[model samples]
Target: MRRGRRKFDDDEADFVKRGRIEPALSEDPDLPETGDRWSTWDNALHGPDPLPEWVRTEHGAVDTELGMLKTGKEADVYLVRRAVPDTDKVSLLAAKRYRDGDHRLFHRDAGYLEGRRVRRSREMRAMTNRTAFGKELIAGQWAAAEFDALSRLWRVGQEGGTISVPYPVQLIGTELMLEFIGDHKTGEAAPRLAAVRTDREGLEDLWRQMTEALSVLARTQIAHGDLSPYNTLVHEGRLVIIDMPQIVDLIANPQGAEFMARDVRNVANWFTARGLRVDQDELIERLSYEAGLL
Candidate 1:
């Protein structure tokens, strides 16, 4: 019996094992066609331009289960998704569609756009003239400026390790696709810090994060002109900055320092109301010094 051990051929063993394994299917039955389900919303009320056919085609396949997360006068944020190829995966993304013809609010302020290189005085005159073509060009530039500032922030913050930004994917006209900073599976919108109450310890952390964000802005030569609780997101004990269409360039704008001071003051005062002690002037000086702007 000890001498009766038998050797199995590799091909025969593989054949026997293959019978137990199921053959691969041609297509995934569980998978659905891209953009099969369509959901519609009122663009006027939502601030998103009507989703273009190509955008829908490229990004509409994932469970875009449309939900209005936040609506402002300028734009609205929609929670969306796009399916990843070759894997049964869906990623949460934010679709911010700026309202068309709504550039009046930001574009009307010539001071904000000052010092930036304009192609021509004629173009600037056209923008100032408010002609149909001029208005459209201004709107396009405004949108492009937001996209540019956001891209800079995303890159600089990540590189400096001072903050985190959702990965920016594309900017199609007034529609911007960004990585959603919330948990979509649970269907919970990321709570803006302004909308939530925090304890003393949490408030201190928030204050620190805000100051750190300011330092990052200064380091990158940009100022978040509209920094406030509403634009700050509290996710997993971290603060994420958003809504930067009004971000200002420090080098180009003479009022950049004032804007930076105001930003610091605004965040500091908000935390002060919550029982956190912060000195606006000191914070501003520190930030300016750290940024080498002082």
Candidate 2:
């Protein structure tokens, strides 16, 4: 299961000279240093087209898969260090790879596919029937949809909006590379909102931030349809919304209004249980108005 660490017999160096690994482990010589020869960068370390401008500036850094960051039913995220061949310009990227093989684990995604166009008739049939090929297709769509959503929200967030998201780097097939939300040097993921219990003022501050994020979504004609304390992250005292492959269309989906109300109610209940009284009804009304749905 370990990737970057080579099991040496005290002959070659046990670790790479200038590579990073998770849990601060030594390197593996069997793994390719530049990563294209391996699966770390999803074999996009060097491609037919040039790398993106932001990453090309690093002069084509090497990606080394450290280890698994997290695993879910649909995908598995890895901790990978992207660094120059022999220099110190390095960044840790989260490589989220959706399942692409016949071993499907996640399902029941039809609810979010309401407005998503299924271009190919056969593909649509297969997906509806839940065939092996259908599962693979759905996996790819999920990754693509999430990447698009993140890109859109991140762009608006850059304009000083309240929403915040992990910076999306690139997407290759089912593999998506994103900016590491936590400390790259340590590979520590930020705590999810469900894991945080703070003092009264701290709780109030978080609620305000959460509301700001919700308003941002409302103004953008989007709703985090699966929003829950579990999907939200608290990093450096800021709210970062994630897992939007199922993001609802505030204007397109037939159940858009219901999804919007449910989103607000789910979060409101969490805060209410934590002793924060909220005008949940009024907040939902204001947000729906902000989203131009009223």
Candidate 3:
């Protein structure tokens, strides 16, 4: 939890010093040491020989550490921190490292990725195609899209009541550095909304928060394509939305209204199960009205 400059032997001192603590080991002996050091394949993937000089110079100096926070089909999120040069301070952040080639799969699923606002046919087709260059382009676009959604959520949440959002910093290639959400000392995953067992009042409060998030998205002209309990975190009695790589511009897609309705319904259903009488239709209407969509 405490952040400080990593200690290195004299031989490794040639590498740039970033402030990050070594990850603690799990009980499993078969697992590799999940910490600040690089694995064999990591070195090969980003080795001095394969990496460009400029890339090495820029990203190399930016310190990184790897360990598991969450593993999904698209990427693995790791807690990463680096020192601000000329200062002893370290910034704690979350690093979402995408699996190489995931863009092709996401792009190919046009039905899933499509919104009410249509993308150009040629561009959509190109994104779906698994060409080398196309995949790279899609990868960059996906990261940027996620960052945009996170920023939108952060700004709106800060403005409207007691919601909180993880601060996103930068997206570098497949790596997205963001504000770390969980407790630092415990190294625990933030509690997802689905994992929490709450009373009726607490559930209603969560329902209100989720509805507010949907309204924020609608007002911002963005639709979180995947908004469910699993991607929502409950921290300190507040809701924090996460995993927004698929957020789409509502104006660009014709199905934006439908998607927003579904998002509202999903949260309503979850709360209903927790003994809260939630009217999905009413919630949807409320958000639409608040967003000036009605």
Candidate 4:
């Protein structure tokens, strides 16, 4: 559970401090004296407004990294706590920092980049050639895409209740801060759908939720290009989708239908294997129609 004041051991404190971006001066004049770094809200691109009250937007707010929550090929999510010193105001954010071109592997990027475009022909050529600059651009694109996708989906889900996504908090270069979907008090993340175990009734309910989420995405003309049980989380019996950096524009991408179908099959097969009667073909057809493909 969250304490009024959390203390970090020597090792933990050192780890957190090492991750901080220091200022030019020995003792940075710009940063607050207490936390690791000042609130980045003043410099970064912000999330959709009517912002949540929990978000610490004030300049007095500072961010401190608690620990890493997840690691992946493209990015690593760290548990970041943003708070106003001497105040009770605090927000827990999952800060997903994308690896730079030199460090990141681009094996899964080609297909997803088909429909996405950059204005400059030079940039496009560089991305196509996988130049050093191009890889950096691609990395930034992934972060921006996911942030934009989550922002749009969060608003839509709030209106319709068919799907759920973390509220995007902010994006700075390749670092995206999102609403941490877990026990805020304990800083423990919810289990992925792949790790969830449930009774028959619960399984059926989750399946229904999954279908509704897919339907909403189809109607919105987007495909979660890499959706799977591993990328989906269940919190308090609610299904929340995550990891959409490769989200496909259903009408724009040439293989959009294939991607959507593949997504459906991936989850449907899992459900069927667990003794659920999933009509994959039927679901696919319905989604295709909803996406205006039929």
lDDT (10s digit) by residue, model 1, range 226-290:
77776777888888888777678887898888888888877787798888888898888887776
Candidate 2 clash pair list = 4-28, 5-27, 5-28, 6-27, 6-28, 15-27
| lDDT tens digits by residue: candidate 4, 44-77 | 8999988989989997888887777766668777
Candidate 3 weakest ten by summed lDDT? 8-17
Worst 10 residues of 1 by lDDT: 10-19
lDDT of each: 0.64, 0.72, 0.60, 0.85
User: What TM-score quantifies how close candidate 2 is to the native fold?
Assistant: 0.80
User: What TM-score, computed on C-alpha atoms, does each candidate reach?
Assistant: 0.75, 0.80, 0.71, 0.90
The C-alpha stretches of model 1 lying farther than 4 A from their native spots are 1-65, 84-87, 102-108
User: lDDT at 210 for candidate 3?
Assistant: 76
TM-score of 3: 0.71
Which residue pairs does candidate 3 place in steric collision?
A: 116-253, 116-254, 116-255, 117-252, 117-253, 117-254
Cα lDDT of model 2 by residue, 98-128, tens digit: 7764644555577777777688999998888
Q: Write the per-residue lDDT of candidate 3 for residues 188-234, one digit (tens) a residue.
A: 55678877888777887787777666767777777677677777777
lDDT of 2 at 129: 83
Q: By TM-score, how accurate is candidate 4?
A: 0.90
In model 2, the runs with Cα more than 4 Å from the true position are 1-31, 34-59
**Model 3 regions more than 4 Å off:** 1-66, 84-88, 102-108, 112-125
What stretches of model 4 exceed 4 Å from their correct place?
A: 1-29
